[model samples]
Target: METLTNDKATLEVQLSTQQKLIANMREELGICKEHKAMAESQSESRGAHLLELKAQLEDAVLSLEAAERRMHDGELMRRRLHNTIQELKGNIRVFCRVRPMSSLEQVGADPDIQPALDFPPSDDLLSAGIILSAPSRDGAATLSKHVFAFDRVFTPEASQDAVFEEISELVQSALDGHKVCIFAYGQTGSGKTFTMLGSEEQPGMIPRSMRQIFESSQGLRQQGWELSLQASMLEIYNEEYKDLLSSKKLSGSNKSTKEGFGSQQPSGEIKKHQVVHNPDGSTTVSELTVVDITQASQVDLLLAQAMEKRSVGCTALNEQSSRSHMVFTLRLEGVNEAKGKRVSGVLNLIDLAGSERVKDSGAAGLRMKEAQAINTSLSALGDVIVALGNKQPHIPFRNSKLTYLLQPCLGGDAKTLMFVNVAPNIQFAGESLCSLRFAAKVNACEINHRKKG
Candidate 1:
């Protein structure tokens, strides 16, 4: 009986051990279920965050596109408004500039020589009018005052930057698809060339204008503007048009002839060029050299080349006087492929020959002939301006090569600005008066409204 009781106790111990193992397994299964639920919740949260990020990215992309579109529209509006402002100022304008006397001129100057030119004290009048006091021809001590007004006037103290500020708007017009003409007019030694083709230390209108165009074009690239410029330079010498950029070398005799004011006959034959007026109101010269201007520096190169080849001669009034009217034409062709728009414009920068009289210039023989030709062309230009100012039915554009070539700028839908450069010296008082009067006439003349092409 004792052996049977011991066996029953061992059986009971084995049963208790198996029940403890079952309880441990159930606890492990419950913990695994809780971990699975937490994992599922984390996955859902991660997916929601991803979707939110995607939506934000999409919103940012849409905003960028909208801003770009607005930028493009704003650029277009800017062009139109800028052009409108220019028109309101005037389609035709004139600015008078008086250059200071040279050091050589100041030496041994007469103490009795009083100041001939005076500026008004008022800021408004200072830029618009100049007073000239000259001694009467009767040899009296009395002074005759002549008051003249113009669109703008620059005194001797004005900087080149200051002068260009007033005309920068006109240069912008050329880029906006309007024909622009800016020319310097004055007698010899009166700073016309200095104003137009200033020294490297002090760049003039042509270089400054080119730099402005380049800078502006680069800025407009973001708005989808692509502008290409073509430049051509020519000179009208003694009623004859000569391409200043011609590759043909001028014969030694030809050079001598020009130096002596045509005292010797030219052995080399000069190519004849014809100016053709297109049905579209564009003027082109036959066989003219047209160079593609990719950079503003190219213009400087061209100016240097032209100056070397241009017709210059010695005269009594001024040595190395420009004996020809130099015309530099920059043709701008721009397109915005994105907007499906295109434009064509031209900028004509002319440096007219000095308008001094033959007697004053002390020219004889062939030189006299050259002076007469220059005077005739200038007279023709004056006549054309007078006709335009009167709004006549017929303008005499064909009266001279200079007038005919500038027909579009003077009479067509173009913006024209004349710089009447003058000398601030008692000796040049008469010439200064004449230039101011002529500039006044030009400022009064009006042309057709500008239409963008």
Candidate 2:
């Protein structure tokens, strides 16, 4: 019986050991199920967080698109506002500039010369009016005071930068897609050329305008605008138009072959270049050479080339006189591809031949003919301006090549600014008076309406 009891005890021990192992295995399986449940919950939370992040990303994308649209709209508004400001100032404006007398002119000069020209001391009248004193024709001792008013008047002390500051706004208008014309009008020694084409140290309007256009175009690129510029230079000499940038030579002419002024050949052969007016108010000359202006430096080279070929001669009134009206045109074409918009603008910078009398200029033969031609064209220009001012039905644009070529800029919705240069000397008092009077008339004349390009 004791042996049987011991055997039972051994079997009981083996059963208990097996039962303990089973319990341990069941407990381990329960722990695994809890871990699996936690893992599933974590996966669900992670999926929910991913969806939230996706929604936020979608919102950000939409916001970016909206901002871009608003930016585009703002740019359009800016252009409109900018143009409006320019129009309010004036569609056509005139500024008078008096050049300081050179040391040579001042040397041995008459002491009474100081009374010839005077600028008002008051700031209110300083830029608005100029007083000119000249001996009356009736009596040498009797002085006549002629007071003139204009849009703006620059004194002899005004620097090139100061002059350009007033003109920078108009230059900006050209980039905003408007036809702009800035021309200098005065006598030979009145500093018209100097004001328009200043030295390297003191750059003038053309260079400053080009540099502004280029710099502005780069800034406009951020607003989705791409601008391209084309430049053309021409000279109107002896009632005929010559391409200053032309490579052709005048056959059988005594003039330098390098100079491209198309004079009549010995065989009576004449090259005719027609000025065609486009429906878009842009003028084109047949056989005119157009250069792509990629940089401002290119325009400098062109100006140098034109100056070399330009017709200039010495006279008693002034040495190195400009015998031709040089017209430099810059065509601006802008495209906003994203907005499906396009703009075309033109800027005409003209340096007109000085206006002087034959007696004063002391011209004979060829020089006399050139002086007559210059005077005739200038007369034609004056006639056109008067007609426009009077609102005449038929403007005399076709009277001269200079007038006809500038028809688009002078009339219609184009922006025009005239710089009436003057010489601050007693000798040029009469010419200065005439110029100031003409400019005053121009400033008083108002255009009917304007439409931006």
Candidate 3:
């Protein structure tokens, strides 16, 4: 009976335990439903937040692009403004010097030239000799009251510094890739040559200018200046252009060959009728002296050779008409070692043949022809200068060989300077006035400066 009671109690305990477990399971199911709902709500919030973040990122990207665009535009505008300022710069610089007069026979002489001081060397180079020293111990006295006294006394060896300063600035422009020009003017026997090309022993502007460039280049080597140089020389004779330094052909070339007229396209460019082409497909150009000179001595050699081959003949008005215009050009093709790009600049040293009176020259035949050509070309040059000064619509650069050759100086990107040589002689009064007027006009011309290869 006792065993039956114990078994009944055990069955009751098992049934209570099962009922507690069912209760606990029901509460857990309700809690799970609440958790699921909260999870759905959080997901929706997260999706909205994600969309906002994407929008912000897109706005940031757009802002960055806009900033870059603005930066590029500002750079472009700044470049334009800088170029405009350079364009407004004027080119004309005129300096007048009344020359001191001394008989060519009285002053220090031309070293490389001799025999006849007034005449150029005949096939015999020494036949024409130069005056060695001042005849009078008081050289200044001979120079003071002489007709050219104003030029000689007022103008000194130091005067070229001013000119070099101007040209030096031009060179800086060229180093930045600008073109430049320098021209000298005076009446026949007025010392234009002296100002442009000093004595052989004491070379003038051209040589000195070249030296300055070389020295400056060396100093600026660290700044990245790489230079390439070329030189060309030509003359306007009898309305005909001649290459004074071109090697003569012993077999086929003759006087006609030297006399042949053709326009020179110096270097390759978009040259039109302004520069004529050679029919031979070759020019006096092929005969050019192309040398790379690192040392100043190398340049000296070239100047010496050029002087010997120079077309110098004696005339009544002056010893040498410069029979040909000698243009000693320095083409500096520099690559900024710093910039890693190329730049080009040119220095033109022009010693123009002074205007002369045929009556004064007492020339004949070929000489007469040279005189007429010189006079005619000079007249045309004067007319062109007047037109340029007036800013007239038409500038007759092609009117004369001299003027035409100078198109680059007057019409192109160049810093131009003209030296007006005057004489103390009362006979030269008219010449002085004309030269001054021409200088004033040249100073007025506005040239277009543009960078080209």
Model 1 steric clash pairs = none
- Give lDDT tens digits, candidate 2, residues 283-315: 656656677789999998999998989999998
Please give the CA lDDT of all the candidate structures.
Answer: 0.80, 0.82, 0.56
Per-candidate alpha-carbon RMSD to the true structure: 7.2, 6.1, 14.6
Better of 1 and 3 by TM-score: 1
- Report the number of the highest-lDDT candidate: 2
The regions of model 2 sitting more than 4 angstroms off are 1-50, 110-112, 121-127, 250-270, 449-453
| Predicted structure 2, TM vs. truth | 0.85
Residue 78's lDDT within candidate 2 is 87
**Per-residue alpha-carbon lDDT of candidate 3 for residues 203-248, written as tens digits (9 for 90 to 100):** 6677777777777777556444567666656566566555444444
lDDT of 3 at 421: 66
lDDT of 1 by residue, 1-453 (tens): 888888888888887787787788788878887888888888888889889989989999999889878887787798889988777666777788989889998895787878889988555632387888766779887878888777788999999999999899989889988889898998988998888889999999999999999999987786788998888888999888887766564432222111001222244555466676777767756546667789999999999999999988899989988988999888888899977999888889999998887767898987787788887888898788768766799899999999998887775557888899888887777777777777776776655542211
Using lDDT as the yardstick, the better of models 1 and 2 is 2
**In model 1, which runs have C-alpha deviations exceeding 4 angstroms?**
1-50, 123-127, 135-142, 249-270, 448-453
Clashing pairs in 2: none
TM-score of each: 0.83, 0.85, 0.59
For residue 73, give model 3's deviation from the true position in Å.
Answer: 18
